[model samples]
Target chain A: MRLGPALGWFSRNYNYEVETQAPLQKHSVGSQQRTPIMYASLFEQKVVPVKHSTKFRDESVMKSKRISKFLWVGALGSVVVVSGLAEKVYPGKVAPSSPAQTTNSASTTGTSGYNVTSSTLAPPPASATAPSGLSATSGSSSSGSAAAAAPTAGS
Target chain B: MRQVLFRQDTLGTSCFLTSRVEGVDFERRFIAACETFSERLFELDQVASRFRQDSEVMRLSAENTGEPVSVSELLFDLVEAAMRAATITGGYLDPTVGNSMVGLGYSKDFELVRRDSADGMHFRVVLPSGYRTLVLDRVTRSISVPPGTILDLGATAKAFVADRICAELEHLYSLTCLVNLGGDISCSYVGQEVPWMVNLTSDGSLDPTSDGMLFGIAGGGLATSSVRSRNWLAGGTPHHHIIDPTSGESAVVDFESITVLAGSALDANIASCGAMAMGHRGIIWLRGTGLPAVVKRTNRTQMDGIARPWNGSELEFIGDWPEELVQLSGGVAC
Candidate 1:
C-alpha cells in the first residue's frame, strides 16, 4: 500500500514527520585527513522517526498503558488501606465471648463478675439505674391534687 | 402551675399527653409540646408499624432476599430497642413472633380483628423464628432477617415511644410531662412536689368512680400488659396479643393483667410482657428484678391439678408499690 497518502490524516492531526540526515563525509585537516566519527547510523538511532501514523499510534498505546498501570496500583493501594482500617475498626467476624468465659475471666482477675459483659454497643437505659430504672413515688403529699389522671389498660 | 391535656388516636389505641407547666403562656407551651409529641408519634408509626404497607418495617419484610437493607435512624433505634428488650427479657418478649401473631388471626388491626367472625377460621401454631437469627449492623445502620422471618415490635414500640416523647418534651419544653400511649405511661420532670395520679384498670375502662387502685409516680415509666382486655376468639378458642415465643401461642397465664414500673417505659413494658409470658413464675422473676409491680390473677377458678391453684381473683403487689389511695364517692383523697 502507498503509506504516505494513507497516513496523511495522522500527519495533519499530530504534526508528526520523519526527517533523514545526510551521510557523514571525510574532511581534510592541516596535519591529517580525519573522517567524521559516526556515533550511530540513522537506522540504528533509538527513536527513529519512521512513519507519522505508526509513531503516533505507538506513543498513544504507551501513554494509555502507563495510565492503566498507575490506575491499577492506585486501586490496589486503596483496597489495602480500606481493608486494614475496616479490620481495625469493625472486626465484624470477631466472635463474642461466652457468658461463662466472661464470668470466669472476671473472677480470675479479682473483679466483680456479671452474667453478661458490659462491653456492648447497646445504649444504657434513659434512667440512672443500671438494670431496672424504676423507683417508687417520693414523699407523702396530702395537699397535692391530681393534675391529670389516666387509666391503665392493656392494648 | 397550670395543667394542659392533649388526646389523639394512635397505634390502634388512644394516646393521652398531659403536661404541667408553670409561668405565663401556658396554652402556647402546651400546644407546642403537643405538636412535638404528635410529630414524633407520626414518625414512629411510619417507621415501625407492621400493618402499614408503606412503613419501613413492611418494606423491609417485602425485601426477603436475606440481604441487609439500610433503614432510617428512627427505625434503627426502634429495632435496636426491640433487640435490647429481647435480650433483657431472656427472649420471653421476642419480636420474632410476627408469624405467630398472624397465624393466630391477628394480621390486621385489633378493631378489625374483633369485628371478623372466627367460626371457620383455622388457627395454626406458628413458632417464632427466634431473635438470634436477626442480623443488625450498627455501623451501617442496616438490618437483615432470614427469608420469611417477620419482626413485630408491638410489645415494646409503644412504650419506647412514650419514653421518647417524654424525654423530647422535657428536653424541648422543659415542662413536667406525662405521656400515656394506650396504657404505657412515662413521666418526665426535674423537681416536682406533686406526683401524677394514675388509675389502674384491667378492663380498659377509665372510671374514677369504679373500684380500682389509684397510685402516684414522680418519675420513670409505668406500663400495664393485660391479657384480658385484648383477648379475641379464634375457632372457639380464645387468644390474646401477647404470644409466648416458646410455643408460638397466646400466653396463658394465671394473671389477668400485670402492671410494672421501671426506669424507662420500654423497660417496664419488657418486664410486663416478659412476666405475662413467664406465667406463674412471673411473680418470682419480678421479685428477683426488684421492680415495683402489681399482678392480678384471673378471677375464674381453674380445674384442680391443671395449673396453679386458683383461689378466685387476687391482687398481688411486689416490691415498693405505693399505697393505694381510696376513691371516695365525691373525690379521691390521700
Candidate 2:
C-alpha cells in the first residue's frame, strides 16, 4: 500500500489528524535516543489531593441535603401559621351562596389593610339599630285615618 | 297591584286624581304624570299665565316693548287655543290684557288678594294690543307678535290641561281617565252614562235653580267661563279681568256665565270664553261647535241649549239648592 493512503486510512479510522510534525534530528553518534520523563512526583501530588478533595465533596453533599430539608419544613410551617390566623380573622359561612362568595371571603380575610362598607340605599332592617342622623322610625299607626279616606273624588 | 294618588296645585285650581293598576308601582306613575303636567304648565306658564315671574305677560310688562320671543311647545299649544278662542268670540276673550286688568286694579289673581288695597288700583282705559298681530309657527313653535302683547291663558290653560291629562292618562295607564282642571273637564271613560252629568254655573256658583234644567254631557268635557265670579270695582268703576279685545275693556255681555259641553274640555272652555267675548255671536259660535251649552243671565232668564243628545222639554227646572249643600263656587244647579 502507498504510505500516504495507508496513513490517511489509519488517520481516518482512528479519527486523528496531525497539524504539524517535528523534524527528525541527526545526532553525532550513530543514533539519537529519546527518553520519556517518569513524573512520579507530579503523580503523587495530584493523587493525594484528589482523595482529600473527594472527602470534602462528600461533606458538601451532606450539607446540600440538610438545606433542602430545612427549606421544605419552612414552607409547610408558613402554610400552617397563615391558616391559623385566618380562622380568627374570617369566620366564614359553611354553606356559602356561591363559589364567587367563597373566593371573595377568602380574599377579604387575607387582605390586612382593606375594609369595605355595605350598601346605604336599603331601609335599615327592623331589628338593626337605625344609623345615626336618620329620622326616627314612625310605624304604620300614624297613617291610619288619612290613608283610609283619601282619593275619594276625582276633580 | 298598587294605587297611586297624584295631587298638585296648577291651572288656577288644585287637582286630585287616583290610579289603581296591576303590575305598576304607584308613585313612579303618579309622579311621572304630575311631573309632566308641571313641566307642561311651566312652559305654558311662561307664555300663557298673567302670574309667574317668567310669564309672557310679566315679561312684556317688564320690557314694555320687545319682539315676541320664540314660543315653546307648551306656549304654542296655549297660544293656539287662545287665538282660536279669540277668533271664535270675535275678540271678546282677549289674551293680551294684563295691563288692562292691572290698570282696572285687578292686577293679581283672585287667590292672591290679601286684604286688597286700593293703592295699586290704576283705572285707565289701557287697550290690549289685539291678538291679530301675534303670529304662530306650528312647526317651529315660534310666535312673533307686536311689542307689548300681554298674553294670558287663564281659561284656556285649564281646558288644555284637562285635554292633555286625559290623553296622557289614556296612553300611559291604558285606562279610562278624566281630568277636570278648575271646571274645564275632560274625560276618557265611556259607559252607560254616554253624556256625563255636567253642572251649569251662575256667577261662579252652582246654578241651583237651573241644575235640572241643564242637559247631560256624555264622554266629552264641559267648561264654563264667566266674569260674574271675579268682578270688582277699580277706581270707582266696576272692572272685570275678562277684557273685550275690541274696546280693550271688560265685556258687557248678556250672559253671566256660559257653560259649553264639547268633545274636549278645551273646546268647551274656548267656546265659553269666546261666547263671553263675542256678546251676541257667542251663542251662534257655540252652536257651531255642535255641543250642548247653557247660558245664564240672558235677559235675566237662564237660556239653556242642550245638544241633540238631551231633549230640551224633558230637562225640568229645579228649585234653589239645599242650604247645606250650597257650593261656594257656583256651577252646580240642584
Candidate 3:
C-alpha cells in the first residue's frame, strides 16, 4: 500500500468533490445552467460519468476557486483586524518603548525637578498675634510679629 | 491686616486654610472661600480615593482593562502630577503601589486598618508595576494602565489638592492664603510682609507644645513624610504605608521623618516621599535638589532606655535651612 497515491486518490475524489459541489449546491444553481469552463481540468481521468461533464467539473472548480479566494482574503482580513485589536489593547506589552527614554525625551518642563531654584524662608507676618497659651516668636529678621503657625507632619 | 483661619476634616485627614483678607465684605468672602475649599476637596476624593469602590481610581484598578479611560480634569492633573513626581525622584516616589499597599495589610482606610487586629493577617510582597507603564493622554484627559496595575496616588494627591486649592483661592477671591492638607502645605504670596509660620513635627499634631520645630516660609509648599505615621502590624510584623516599589515592601530607613520645602506642595511631597524611599541616598538626592529639608532620626540608645527625651533625637538640616530663631526647651527650632 503506497501512501502517496492512496492519499492523492482520496483527496482528488472525495475531498475535491465535496469542496466543489458544496458551494454550487448552496448557491441553488442547477447543473444545467452551468457557467462556461474558465480553467483547464485538474484531473484528466474521470471515475464516474454524468451529464454535461465539462460544465459540471468547470463550474465546480470555478466556484471552489472563488470560494478559496474569498476564504484566503477573509482569513487575511481577520488576521489584520485581530492584530490591530491586540495592539490597541496591549499597547505597553506589544510595543514596549522604554519609559526612561520617553520621560527624557518629553519636551514638557517642570517634570524632572522642583520648579524653584532654592527654598525661601521669610520673616513672621506683621500685625498677626498668636492665640492665648501659644507663644508667638519671630525669626531673626524681626520686622513683623508671628501668626498662628500651621503644623506639618507625616500622615 | 485681618486674617481668618478655617479647619475641617476630609480625605481621612485634617485640612487647614489660613487667609489674610482686607475688605469690607470679609465675612461673605471668607464663607464663600470655605465653601469652595470643601467642594474642591470632595471632588478630589471622589476622583482619587483608593478606598472608595466608586472612585475613579478604584474603578480603574478593578476594571484592569488596558484601555484609555476618560477621567475628570482633576484626576488627570493628579495622575500627571504623580507621574511628574516619579520622573523627578527617579521612580523613588511611585504612584503604582496600590496592590503593594493592600498586600501589606493596608487594604482599607488607615483608620479602619488601625482598628482591626493584625494577629492572623497574612501578606505577600506585591511589587509595583512602575509608574512608567501608565499611559496618559493630555488631549483626551484619559489615562491607561497595564492590566493588574493598581495606582495609589496617596503620595501626591493631597499635596496636589492643597496646591490647587491655594491657587484657586488666590485666583478667585484675591486672598493671600495658605492651604494645608494633612501635613502638606501650600501658600500663595502677594508681597505681604508676613510669612506663613509652619510647625514641623514627626507626628501630625496641631498642639503647639508638641516637641516640634517652627519655620517661616514666605510662599511655596512644605511636606513631611515619616515612617512613624500610618504604620501597622501584619502577622506580627510592622508595616508602613510608604511602599518601596523596588522591593514591594515598606521602606526601611534610618530617619524617622523627612520634611521638604519646594515651590509647590506637590513638589515638596514628592521630594519627601522619594527621600523616604531612597533611605540613606535621600540626603544626597535632597542636597542635589537644593531644596531646604530637615531630617530627624530617633536615637537608637534612647529608644533602648525606658524614658526618651525629645533632645535624644538628632536633626539634620540641609540646603539653606534657616537658623533657629525661637527654640522650645529641648526641641530643635529652625
Among the numbered candidates, top DockQ falls to: 3
**Tens digit per residue, CA lDDT, model 2, A107-154:** 211111101122111110011111111111122110001001111111
- Give per-model CA RMSD: 34.0, 44.6, 34.5
- TM per prediction: 0.67, 0.54, 0.68
Cα lDDT tens digits for candidate 1, A34-117: 111111111111111112123443454346556656875896798778767777888884322221111111121112122232
Residue A37's lDDT in candidate 1: 15
List, residue by residue over B148-189, the lDDT tens digit for candidate 1.
Answer: 877899998888778777766765776677888878887763
The TM-score between candidate 3 and the true structure equals: 0.68
lDDT of 1 at A94: 32
Please give the lDDT score at residue B70 for candidate 1.
85
**Model 3, global lDDT:** 0.61
* For model 1 chain A, the run of ten residues with the poorest summed lDDT: A40-49
Estimate, for each residue in B1-334, the C-alpha lDDT of model 3 and write its tens digit.
3344555556666666667656666556655776687777777777888877888888888896899988777777778778877887888878899989988888776767876644457778898989989998876878898898888999988987787777677667777788888788877753324456666653545433355665566667778888675888877788898878899999877668788877667767877888888877777777778777777765541222133234556677776664332422222111
Report the C-alpha lDDT of model 2 over B75-94, residue by residue, as the tens digit: 56666666766665556666
DockQ of 2: 0.00
Interface quality of candidate 1 as DockQ: 0.05
**What are the per-model DockQ values?**
0.05, 0.00, 0.06
| Winning candidate number (lDDT) | 3
Model with the higher lDDT, candidate 1 or 2: 1
Candidate 2 or 1, higher DockQ: 1
